[model samples]
Target: MENQAFQIGKASLLTKQSMGEPKQLTSSIVILVLATNIVYISNMLNLVTYLHDRMHADIASSSTMVTNFVGATCAFALLGGFLSDSYISRFKTMLIFGPIEFLGLASLALQAHLPSLQPPKCDTVNEWNSCKKMSNLDASILYLSLYTVALGEGCLRSSMASFGGDQFDENDPIESQQKSSFFNWYTFDKSLGGLLGLIFIVRIENNKGWDYGFGVSALVILFGLVSVASSFSFYRIQRPRGSPLTRLLQVIVAAFKKRKLSLPENTDDLHQLDIKEETFGMEVLSHASGLEFLDKAAISHGSTGAWSLSTVSQVEETKIIIRMLPIFLSSLSCYICNPLLVIFTVQQGNTMNTKLGKIHISPTSLVIIPLTFQIIFLVLYDSLFTPFARKFIGYRTGITQLQRISVGIISMSLGMCVAALVERKRKRVA
Candidate 1:
């Protein structure tokens, strides 16, 4: 009887172990992410044209609207991240938001399909001046649908990445190393999804109709939601780690309240979690130097435990975020290229001969050329460039993260310069 009981317990443990493996969790997540990107990028790539051609908006107005929409969608990720870490789990966030995304896409598809929702066709070439303006009702529906999609996207993006990372047990060195590889594959999947959307879905919208294209997007998201749901049992869900914002704020408030306190001489005097065995246990970060002012928060005051004291780890987390602020701000500059490239490329396509043999390609579809190049370049960088750089520099990791970021910034600048030169030439020819 004792031997049988032990065998049953061992079997249960093995089952649980197999269920939480990265392979089982990551496959479902990649599918969901790929589907979501296909829907998102397909709609976004044609949004400017949708506004100008379907809604009869002017060039400047359409461009501004697209820019504002993109900015709002990107900004919503912060709110999503905060909510995921504070109140709800990442799994719950995605589950709730996925349907909201579907509703938004469905609304857009319905509006496109129904005749009453759209304005009458205009003679864009000859009677361009006499084009009818969009009704308030139509405008309202358009804005509502677009912003709803943005909100859903905001809720999903940050949480999804963190959620994927949570599947791996970071305590295991092998699993921890796989986390970086998971991120690389995640990015690759995103790029591939976007490329497919640009090449196929955008082309369908251009030739077939907006309704069909949006309908495809709506269906893809529905499939994604279903795919995610199927993996519910396998996912290693993490509980909310109390609000990070609240913790950061606590550090600030504590530091301010104890402004007159004297600093301790030895770092050991500071309050910190009693963590044992740094290698396999809770990470025990060393005392960071530069932020001397914030370190006062860690000074133990008489037993009132509220705002009077914090752990060294908490103080260091705040300092790390503060230090990273500059890099985050610099990264925002990379987005400036999107509006320039999308808006101008479409305009150039309109004027230039887009015929290749028998097919008449859409100007917006031309954006895929650069996307294709990006995919090829990523492969070369990973396969050819990294090994060469590692051999030359004697660095085990090839190049540091900061150096890679610098290279990206330089590459973006050169691309923008080339775009400007092309635009100049096109204008001269006209």
Candidate 2:
């Protein structure tokens, strides 16, 4: 009965489009992001080491497994977003995926603790050549747990930022500014959690055991789930916005079905909704010239329409998304290149000095150096730089999203060059 009432209340909130208060945001999305980063970053950053040292896998095998796991997690984000927009609301998506992540973490902790569940650990690195490698059963269990976590993490991430941003209304200039600053600080909180994960959790895994480290991570996620659940009333549960996939498919189907018909000459001939009468707040996109084939989708054929007809707004929206594909594909180069650099650097750092007096630092923990800088940079960018730059740039958040992506690509190439030079210096010094 209580659960039923809670569900009803959530449904009401969904319809209302309630804006989350600051206190509610702190307990829910803030904790969710922070907890997620801490648990995931700590585990994934040292996953290769765990596979090689504890699971007794070769370096190449360990790296491959880690890379694939990372990639799987990213891919799951697409599925999650689709589910959120199409069927279940984003809040519900988070609720469902959060527990799945917890189960994965718990299972991993169990596997790490029990020697019977693990392969025979090599006594020395040199012994790996003669070692049998991780048993099939052990490897299967590891994969299951890792992918389970990946699915949950990916889905959760798909909704997390969007959910958080929805809390602040963009209509009010103040709330709009808060929304911009909110993401920056949200990232800072997440980075701070990751920094702790690297410095503290990694050390625990190194000094104590993977079991203990994973156990703590599981507990943190559990707390995060509870936090999200407890803050249920405070959340602004948005109604499911119709899926982009469905819309795109509709456009394609409409276009194909109407392929035999000739297109109307005037851009205004394309079917469009009366903005004042139909659309409330939605932006009615202007019909763009490029994808004229898609314009067939917006053709008003007979007196009636179903899947074979679409509005100009719908067709234009699909066209815009299609146009962005090139930029999206181009961005993949950074993801492909940067990950290899990160994995290689972690391997290299393992051979470097990791001690500060009595404290023995885990090589994986060295990531906190970059994370620390990131946190500081975010603070300065949001508090100092963005406002200062807004004076000249004439845009919110200092620049467009496209400009940011371009800058990220440039930075990725620079980082690779710097890393190559640094690796040479380290080799010569050694």
Index of the highest-lDDT prediction: 2
The global C-alpha lDDT for each of the candidates, from Candidate 1 onward, is: 0.78, 0.81
**Ten consecutive residues with minimal summed lDDT in candidate 2?**
1-10
Taking the tens digit of each residue's C-alpha lDDT, what string does model 1 give over 124-221?
Answer: 56776898888999999998998888888878887888888977766566676567567767877787788889887897787889888888888888
Q: Tell me which residue pairs clash in candidate 1.
A: none
- Counting clashing residue pairs in each candidate, in order, gives 0, 0
Alpha-carbon TM-score of each model against the true structure = 0.89, 0.88
User: What lDDT does candidate 2 reach at residue 344?
Assistant: 80
